[model samples]
Target: MLQARTICATVALAGVVLAAGAVPAAAATAAPARAAVTCPTGWGSGAKSDSDSTATPLSDIRTGRHDCFDRMVVDVPGAASGDLGYSVRYVDRLYQDGSGRHIPVAGGAVLEVRVAAPSYAPETGEPTYPARAGHPLPGVNLTGYRTFRDARFAGSFEGETQVGLGVRARLPFRVLELPGRLVVDVAHTWTAGG
Candidate 1:
């Protein structure tokens, strides 16, 4: 009787150990995987979108061709209750007077980017278009398509500004705005390949 009881207890302990070993395997199968977002052709990488009190963060973004141009839009949040105002549009040229050089426009596709926000003035209730800082704006390029020539910010209109990229054909593209910056990536796809 004593020997039989000892054997039963050992079998129970073994079963417990086997059960413990199965947990991690089950967890590995149960966890969900994250999906990766990538850009299509004529787009760059690292695109994402978000917002804050001072600015609405828009980056790594792209839009399909509508009419004659591709449109990229970004929203700028107001810092205070009435402290936001701006606009955006496309232009034919972007001039740099200090360097005395003109950035050549791309050939195939025309890109138009715009931003609209309110002006921060203590006295005026009317909205005014503020000048964009002459700093470098975001850029987009074309890949896998020879028709694409180059991309650059053309200029601004009223309050809207434009960045133009030359492209040969209108291809599928994607845009992303990650934290602190934005990106646009372009890739080619086929029906057979995943």
Candidate 2:
């Protein structure tokens, strides 16, 4: 009886040890298997449309950086509702919106950006996004971005504006509508694991 009790205790103790060891081993194996950060989907190589219309003209165009992607923002006053639409896609070459002149870009890929709303005043046909002759025009300084090379105004006409984006490589991109602005984000990679 004494030997039987000792054997049973030893078996039970061994089972407990095995259970404890398994918990850590399972955790370790699952560590690398952790779910990676998922980027927003349904943003593909095509025109993304937001039918909601806005008369508010674009006030500014800018770019910022994030861990996963680079951001471009088109600012328009009083556009809190997503009444604006856009067409953002990769292209073989860029052209001036009104003149149809070929634009030379700095990178391997070109992103033609078209905004549905105008960037000018209707009454006097005044310039909202003023252009500089013989200069590169208003563009963001993409000093440290992994994918972005350059961005500039292609042109604006017929109540639409165009901005051309030059990138190191053709990359995944997304667009959004925020208060007073339309945003474009180009991803650093297909999956931003961080």
Candidate 3:
């Protein structure tokens, strides 16, 4: 009877150990939970603009995704060369600058990004940025972005080039002028972790 009781106790101990080991294995296989996103404040959705103009040519346009916002960078001559003037405003509809025709943009809201610089070389008038009106901007892919849905070239006429940004909603956004880039960041949520 003593031997039988010892065997039963050992079996129970082994069962407990096996169960404990299974728990860790199961936990290791489970996917990790993503952390909540915290966003910045004071970036309103109304309109952000700078009147400073640049003689430097518009060279490129690019996009990126962040934890709290989606970013659009407009490449141009460095600030050392000249300051870049930009007008970024939310609009009901986007229109081509030179032709005044409607430019189709995909999203719940549109931001008309107007850079106060030409898309062509000033001296030779040769095109520097090949984005055309009423079409998707070259090399810009908005896949899997939380705030940005699409980007379309509105037009480039005179000294300014316009591009339309389509976002999920009229979220808060801010624009910054860096050394050789104009950065536009649109928030993913209204408040922190929202």
Candidate 4:
């Protein structure tokens, strides 16, 4: 009888434990669910954000690669340089910034990056980032980037300088002016990690 009572108690304990477990399982299933976080499309134009012109001139142009996008940074000296605004967009054809002559680039799409700061020194009329004969800026190397095909210095007019980027296709691009630098990020595709 004692053995039988022990077995009955064990069975009752197991039943209570199972009932407790089921309550939590049902509660978990009834809980609300959340959707995955999705990023916005990279292609589009940003509102024109202007700033006071700077004497701190653009000193260098550099490019790098990321998992999702290609980056181009225009190095400047100080706040004056960062405050300089920019206009970046997809264009049908890249023309010389000042003269408007047609410039034939190497890709199916062209991104025109026009900066409010010049790449030259103001006092002596010398270039901070000297223009290369056949290349875009003085020391840009686009050897391995998948989306970037060609880039060129598209001249400076008034208080702005232009840089033409030849890309694989008409993808999205963004221009950001920070203190001492102007940055351009080009998406590799319409979807992330493409």
Candidate 5:
């Protein structure tokens, strides 16, 4: 009985040590640098529409403003069924503020554009393109927005990829691919007021 008790105690101690060592080393790394940007009051609180599509109610939209830009959260319906690949990123030269300052967004105006293909996997709930390999299909262009640039696959948090854009204004945007929807959350930047 004495020997068995000692063995159990030793096993428990080893388990604790192993668990402590299993933590990821990257957790100690510094966070990415962020900038301070402002959003208009109630700016992110309304429905928006794309020229090619109708307006969508702003339910899933979230407010985000960074050093040189503001953002919108595009919530996708969990039960949505479609053959579209979607992504979001910042765009440059899409719109200009009052001071003519081009908005510095992460992706462009066509942030998070996804094209659905026939081979999309239903089980995993992720789009797949054979010709593109690890990337999604090309994105669409916004009419009357000359500064709104193109879109491309970019790195993101949690090992996922997002579509990036280069825009001219610090606009908040959301894209709903299921019903072919896109919403731009426009707010007057603080700089535009003064």
Candidate 6:
């Protein structure tokens, strides 16, 4: 009788343990689901411009790649945020600012970036950002970038500097003016990471 009781106890303990585990497993299966990923909206492909101008000449050009977009930054020394002006728009073709010569860019679409600051120092008339002779910007490589195909310095003339950004297509883009910098970002696609 004692052996039979022990066997019954073991069976009873296993049943209780299984019931407890089943409750927690069911609760875990009923947990809430996660939200889906959504891409940013409202940034368009139209022309973006600001009328503000700065006497501080643009000194440098740089670029970066991100998860959803590619970026280009123009450095303007001694200029405050929102003090610099820019006109960023998709164009059929890119051309030199002063010479009006056609600039051949490599991509399906071209972004004409016009900053309202010279690339030269006004005091000494020396180039702060030197000319590129239609070549890609120094140190900017677009080999693995998702949005950018090529970038060239179009020209700097009459207190304005222009750059040609060759992109994969006419994608949405935005311009941001930070302290002493003008930034342009081109989205990879209509949906983020698509």
Best prediction by lDDT: 6
lDDT-best of 1 and 2: 2
- Tell how far residue 128 is off in model 1, in angstroms: 8.6
Give lDDT per model, in order. Answer: 0.40, 0.77, 0.89, 0.76, 0.37, 0.89
Which residue ranges in model 2 land beyond 4 Å of their true spot? 1-42, 133-139
Give stretches of model 1 more than 4 Å off: 1-5, 32-72, 76-134, 137-157, 164-170, 173-194
Prediction 4 global C-alpha lDDT: 0.76
Write one digit per residue (lDDT tens) for candidate 5, span 117-141. Answer: 2223444544442223223223333
CA error at residue 61 for candidate 1, angstroms: 9.4
Expressed as tens digits, the lDDT of each residue in 46-160 for candidate 1 is 2222332233322222333332223343333323433323222233454533353465555544333333222222244333323233423344334434333555543433333
Worst 10 residues of 5 by lDDT: 51-60
Which residue pairs collide in model 3, if any? 52-85
Which stretches of model 3 miss by more than 4 angstroms?
A: 1-36
**Candidate 5 stretches greater than 4 Å from native:** 1-41, 44-139, 155-161, 172-194
Shift of residue 43 alpha carbon in model 5, Å = 2.2
Worst 10 residues of 4 by lDDT: 39-48
CA RMSD (A), model 4:
8.1
**lDDT of candidate 3 over 22-111, digit per residue (tens):** 998999889798877667898898777778887788889999999889999999865542388889999999988868899889999999
Clashing pairs in 2: 52-83, 53-83
Q: Estimate each model's TM-score.
A: 0.35, 0.73, 0.81, 0.71, 0.28, 0.79
Ranking by lDDT: 6, 3, 2, 4, 1, 5
Which ten contiguous residues of candidate 2 have the minimum total lDDT?
131-140
TM-score, candidate 3, is 0.81
Best by TM-score: 3
Deviation (Å) of 78 in candidate 2: 1.0
- Mind giving the per-residue lDDT tens digits that candidate 4 earns over 15-85? 99999999999999998896553534655544334555666678788899876678889887775544777
> How well does candidate 5 match the true structure, expressed as C-alpha RMSD?
19.0
